[model samples]
Target: MSPEPYLGDTTRTPIRHHILSVLVENKPGVLARIAGLFARRGFNIYSLAVAPAESHARFSRVTIVVDAESAPLEQIVGQLDKLVNVVAITDLAPRDALERELLIASVPVDDDNRLTVLDTITHGGASIVDVGATSVTVMLAGTPDACDELERSLEKFSDVELHRTGRVALPRLG
Candidate 1:
């Protein structure tokens, strides 16, 4: 379904985030064009993930989480629609979409905090992927909120490195 045109509606409050599942031709420079379009229009993207769609490599799906507060949702979609490579754009409201994110962190551990770190990791539903003499690497694949919580819990470590794969989502089927 297309989004309602947001023409300066002061009475209505805008949603903070809007996920756009964009289908595009699998070709070089398509991403560049899309990024350039957002840059030109000054729309802020919160998270973006792209991958080949279905069994064929002829098309790719781009899941873009846009900051709705940054620009009018209608204009963002309109600019994206103007691109020739873009096949289709589906705006998925947070409730209508199922989203997931992956976060990997390598946190330092000493005798003092090793047990506490492991406890935090297990409590957060994260798996210990790798263990070392000085650190442990944990992987968490879950909802965005869960990942954020796990990250926050790990911040007590002095040396922790985190890498997150920005959100990827699909429309929920009734």
Candidate 2:
């Protein structure tokens, strides 16, 4: 086994809460390069979200979370921009960003149920994405602060599982 490489000085205290926004051409291995960059730099990413940015062409918007000093983060983005497919890369975590979060909870079903399915729909912006005899998938998207409140409401039901995606944010363009 081999130890991972460090992107910056291996001795510095950790710097928390850094976000990277990437615009890359949607291709077969584009994602690999982006992920590789972080790994090569010895950066530990906290959250990653990638989705299609353009419908016409194969383009994607990737958001990655890391803890690094200013110079390292800047260099990471700078190097990425130098690539042929990298359209743009910005560290949006410390910038003027708009953030959102999503939580999907699954609840089990039983013979005697006090709170019916409809009861769950009306609370906490919960929307039924799927429903079966055994479980139900309810999705809620909003600020992280409110996610806790929603979670509490779901506790009353037969919640069996929870899935959380990392917080996502983009600069608030004026």
Candidate 3:
């Protein structure tokens, strides 16, 4: 099966990142099947995030970011649609979507640099979630760029541990 071309300027050769919002059955192994398809097709996934969808346990949402130049977008979408558990797929345009990622960082903060660390976090619009005598854990939910900026600033601190959730997005509605 072949998917219809939904992306404009299919002839363009520049590498562009695309976000695919997939709705699938929440049953086991659904994620693996989708991921397997990408692997078999030699498509590289830049980031992927999966979570429950709506208020029901019967569906899950998988948000995947891929480089369009790495594989034919139509072919990828077609293969994904063939999966038995897949319900829907939406290709979100970066400018027309609301996207966010969550980042958590644990930084060593002694008396000397505690204020500096806190100030950096505050400047990044992040909040301290946990504070210990020697370290502080902060959480930030924002765009990928914002998270990257925060990560770079936090790197100056000692013993910093950081983790980020992949991008997740929903199309904007009028």
| Candidate closest to the true structure, highest lDDT | 1
lDDT of each: 0.85, 0.67, 0.82
Worst 10 residues of 3 by lDDT: 1-10
What are the TM-scores, per candidate, against the unseen true structure? Answer: 0.89, 0.68, 0.88
Give the RMSD in angstroms, all C-alphas superposed, for model 3: 8.4
Sort the predicted structures by TM-score, highest score first. 1, 3, 2
For 26-91, candidate 2 gives per-residue lDDT tens digits of 888998887786677766677788888868467788887666653477677676777688887777
Residue pairs in collision within model 1: none
Candidate 1 per-residue lDDT over residues 1-174, each given as its tens digit: 212111222112136789899999999999999999999999998988999998869999999999988899999999999999999999988777777778899999999998999999987878889999999998887777777778898988887999998888887789
What TM-score would candidate 1 get against the native?
0.89
Residue 38 CA displacement from its true place in model 2, Å: 1.0
List all candidate RMSDs to the true structure: 8.1, 10.5, 8.4
User: Which of the two, 1 or 2, has more lDDT?
Assistant: 1
Model 3 clash pairs? none
